[model samples]
Target: MSPSGKPPRAVDIVRRGLLTRPWRSAVEAVRPPWSPQESQFTQACTRCGRCVEACPGGILQRGDGGYPAADFRHGGCTFCYACAGACPEGLFLPRDGRAWDIVATVTAGCLALQAVECRRCQESCADGAIIFRPVAGGLWQPQLNRSACSGCGGCVAGCPVSAIKMEHSHGRSLAGM
Candidate 1:
């Protein structure tokens, strides 16, 4: 652990992974859409587990020891941004408006696929946005009720295989030009 009290071992493990994971590296390398709300927010975040500990939803976790990774599996982020408020480094940049600007996507490994009848993700959703529907093969597929989805990204973290993805929801549109 260094002066910030974050464990060196944990930091090293995350750093190594980020250095090797091209996809993750690419995302972090992308210039933030906007400057952090606080001038020191970007630099002061030590990637320590403090903010994560403060998270009541367990949605916030260490993302390469750099940013807050929110998983919206159990529930969506209430836009509370509590982790941001608790961050000592002020690294968590608040959008001030449009909290759903960050969107989380649940990938292939949905809980239903793991088990024929498991509705763990749906049940975990406090917003009741995820619905299970019978598909072509009588298999239940989890559908996102967009109106109910708040883009909390909590599902991403709870995933055993990290099948969830967090994406910027407000950017480019697919409408025909």
Candidate 2:
């Protein structure tokens, strides 16, 4: 009912419906680049979709609780800072700071590690972080150059065996994949 104590119109009903859409509890999701710590980000963000919509790489998506999340299945980040510019809440940190400690790691499931000739991940990487090094067994093993890795996740989806994963560099897992 309105303040006038009369019936609401159709537009009012639709607006209420949209505002009342079911909201899920926050979870461990991959946040966009230059985002603050998860705890701080959730607290500071206002659930506006501007950051996700401003991403030129198309890697950002509307995630849990209508928050912005990074999805790298399609492409790598160009580090264009469009998301940060679009944010009205100023939740993201400065671009000069490190974009988290995340980095790409090649798991044992990699086809190249199994004595199979595969280089899809290497081909997809724009940073040249994945290096094929010769091992004692005369097999070319894919070695990760942590310093060179940008953690853009470009190689993850291109791996034929799904062997690539992004994780914190200090052995702590990122919780949600």
Mark the regions of model 2 whose C-alpha exceeds 4 Å error after superposition: 1-27, 175-177
Could you give candidate 2's per-residue lDDT for residues 86-111 as a string of tens digits? 99998889999777678888888989
**TM-score: which candidate is best?**
2
Cα lDDT tens digits, model 1, 1-177, are 678997765448777777777744345321122225323544655666666677776655555446554444444455555565665665654566545444445566766665556665666566676778888877897787666765555555445565555555543211000
- Candidate 1, superposed: residue stretches over 4 Å from native: 1-21, 28-54, 61-81, 84-96, 111-115, 157-162, 170-177
Who wins the lDDT comparison? 2
**What's each prediction's clash count?**
12, 0
Model 2: clashing residue pairs?
Answer: none
Query: What is residue 117's positional error in candidate 1, in angstroms?
Result: 2.5
Whole-structure CA lDDT of model 1: 0.54
